[model samples]
Target: MNKKQSGIIVTLVVLIVIAGYLATKVNGPLYVNDSDFNEKTAISLKEGKSSSTFFTEATLSRDQDNAKTLQNIKALIDDANTPKEQKATAADEYLAVATATQNESDIELALKAQGFDAALCSIVDDKVEIFVKSSKKELSKEELRGIQDVVMSKTKLEKIDVKIKE
Candidate 1:
């Protein structure tokens, strides 16, 4: 093949590979990986720093997802083809999402106040799930109880699950 033709083929192959890698990355789960969380937590602990210091990217992704969800719900509420009852339901769902997002922030702040580095809360379909980043990488029974107490008190919901990550 001519040098120019060979160069074109190589460029095309490189582009294909790059596209495939990006596709997988975009499609993967949005949550922070265990290794990343652990590494950040270790460094923070070593430096006597809070987990929030390293939380920017994960928190931004979570906020973006939350915004997208709210936007989608708002679109449903505003759609002309939607029935009145459905629109009303969508409005309620939107409120729920907004409240949940606020509650997540409240929980994160509360955890931080109590000395945690980072925390995330998600409320869905009557269930609340919390993820906390602790220096120890795991929660003691007392810590779990305390978290459950805080979440239940804030959300007024009986169902809660809390996970601690490094």
Candidate 2:
């Protein structure tokens, strides 16, 4: 090939290589073909803690929001004044609330994707613990009931130790 033709071909090859690298990096972890996805959260659950879906990608999405929530939850745990037992209890409460919110959101997204009109089920910490305004609202009674059933059923869980709130 002539010098000009060789130069053009070299440039095109370099560009193609760069483009191929970018494509692989972008699509490497999409899990499109996989049936399940899961990533570790900032706060590690207790050893016995259980989750509905073993591999969950929805919980992994909106990571920025999760980070902020985790920070706030940690602060709450730090701010609590009590004995070790009390602190542990408080931490468990916090985990339950946080996990419930994340789990509910993941469930909502999945349900919505499957053509179910879904809504956020408020995390029920306790009878006295009123929900703050930040929690997502229930979309409908039927959806809420459906979520309630799922949450209560204790089936399709990745772990067996985590207790479902009734």
Candidate 3:
């Protein structure tokens, strides 16, 4: 590959790796200071601390970020300077990211449809981190199992965590 092709490939790989590391763990001591956690905010919905506004904002931010990234990838794919191989690879990665984004939304909606007050689903590589809100402070065994069933049916990811809020 030419220098330009190699550079583009490297950049795409790095972005994919970083995206997968975004997160899904909410069980930890609350960090009042913003610097204590990743700026992405989606990294951990703060377990029991998430309010409806926070949940809405987090999902909105995540989707906006994905849209921006997808736009950049599309530019690369359309660039005349991009090699054929690079374009093909970029297209595949673009599709993967887009599909994952849609899957996350779908999972959330399905969970809500199942009767949860609010739901957030994060798909990080082979794992999925889910947080659901309800009036009850504790989730029953059946409730937890039902959440898992919704996710499993929607996605085949290996590790799924239905985090117990707080």
Candidate 4:
């Protein structure tokens, strides 16, 4: 082999070795978008085999304070600007609207599924808002809308807004 060819071959060999070492030394894959880190890192940090662990529904009964709030909602709905005799007819719609407009369980589940720490929930002005915290991005608007739709179907309210902590 000629000297020039040997020199080029040696340079290429050195580059390959350096590249291999760098790749191996990397602690984790590069994350560019919010989701890139949220999904993958969340997956790694979670323990055990099931993703279900992260998505488990927040137990309502466990939170005595929120349970009392829910009781107050029942009373409010009873006294809402609607007739008593006609209440039965609107029962389905009432339940649907109230729950959809105020339900926070599903939202809690979604937040947990995404590996975020979510709180019980608070009902303000007939709206259900949840407080969530995490190193990752907060829950998305679309997700909250879906949960709201479920609760809205139970109430008399025409529209409801479900807010997530920022």
Best by TM-score: 3
Instruction: For candidate 3, write residues 1-166 as lDDT tens digits.
Output: 8999999999999998776555323344322333554755444445455578657776876876787788889989989999999999999999989888989999999988988778888888889999787767788999888888887888877688886432
Off by over 4 Å in 2: 1-73, 79-82, 125-166
lDDT of the structure predicted as candidate 3: 0.79
Sort by lDDT, best first: 3, 1, 4, 2
lDDT tens per residue, model 4, 1-166: 9999999999999999998778867855432234443543343323342333332333332333344444554554577686776566556545644554345555455555655555444444555545554344555677665555544543334345444332
In model 2, the worst 10-residue window by lDDT is 126-135
Instruction: Sort by TM-score, best first.
Output: 3, 1, 2, 4
Candidate 1 global TM-score: 0.61
- Residue 165 lDDT in candidate 1: 60
Estimate the TM-score of every prediction. Answer: 0.61, 0.32, 0.67, 0.29
Tens-place lDDT digits, model 2, residues 17-99: 99988998987842232233345434342334333221132234434445556665566567746567766776886677567
Q: Give the CA lDDT, 0 to 100, for residue 135 in model 3.
A: 65
User: What is the Å distance of residue 115 in model 4 from its true position?
Assistant: 1.4
What is the alpha-carbon lDDT of model 1 when measured against the actual structure? Answer: 0.77
Instruction: Return the lDDT, model 2, position 115.
Output: 48
For all candidates in order, the CA lDDT equals 0.77, 0.47, 0.79, 0.50
The alpha-carbon RMSD values of the candidates against the true structure, listed in the order shown, are 12.3, 16.3, 15.1, 21.6
The parts of candidate 1 lying over 4 Å away from their true place are 1-55
